[model samples]
Target: MSAKTKYTDEPIGPVKVIPDFLPPPEELVFKEDTVKVTIALSRESVEFFKREARKHDTQYQKMIRRLLDAYAVAHSKAKQNEITAKRPARRR
Candidate 1:
């Protein structure tokens, strides 16, 4: 058995008040524009996502969507860089 905690009435030194740094309730709820699509994926891939999702306690479809979104974002930035690199410098 553990010893019981003792309560003290001692003053806890100077305290600073911090402003609210969190967003409002409405802003806390994120709403993303999404579209429904039907596509066939390999059984192995689907199973993999399902297993991972179950382990993380989240929806498998969300994991797949986030993966695809991340891939698209990364590739898009790389494509933009390639395009900029190919552009000739102005003879100002």
Candidate 2:
């Protein structure tokens, strides 16, 4: 038997679900240097980011850029360490 059937014999009626929509305010203009990026994500994660971005009054792309920059710095440091480790030991 399915888990739903095991848990409850009756069907659950209309669970109040929240709609995922953001109404942008008027007079919003993006700068010329700004570039648009489309990232593929699961529906839930996208909604989470959208909510967080709305809370901060900043675009999701800006938040993603900041995160990417931090990730890049850490990744570069790890790569540098790996390169250094591969070098042969020098004798005096």
Candidate 3:
């Protein structure tokens, strides 16, 4: 075992204000109504989410819900785009 090393006093550089380039956090939120339903899953599947949830410190049910929500949103957008593509373009 070695003793802790001592450090000489060092000065920090002056701080400069940087422009904020990220979007506001509020923009990311959209409330959605939810319904509760009972469902069954394989032990392996539940275990996987539970393990992942533990690592991230969140409920497995919430993670599963978000995954389903994202899937539905993506598929809905793709379907909308496909339908739009099939319609004739309007004259300017």
Candidate number with greatest lDDT? 1
Model 1 lDDT tens row, 49-77: 99999999999998898788767867797
Which runs in model 2 stand beyond 4 Å of their true positions?
1-38, 90-92
Each prediction's Cα lDDT score?
A: 0.86, 0.71, 0.84
Better of 2 and 3 by TM-score: 3
Comparison by lDDT, 1 against 3, better one: 1
Q: Output the worst ten-in-a-row residue range by lDDT, candidate 3.
A: 19-28
- TM match of model 2 to true structure: 0.49
Question: Using lDDT as the measure, what is the rank order of every candidate, best first?
Answer: 1, 3, 2
Global fold similarity of model 1 (TM-score): 0.66
**lDDT of candidate 2 over 1-92, digit per residue (tens):** 66563565788888998653332455235442556777787888768778899999989766766567567767797899999999999999
Error of 2 at 91 (Å): 5.6
* lDDT of each residue in 1-92, candidate 3, tens digit only: 99999887897679899754433578458665889999998999999999999999999998898788767877797899999999999999
- Collision count for each candidate, in order: 0, 0, 0
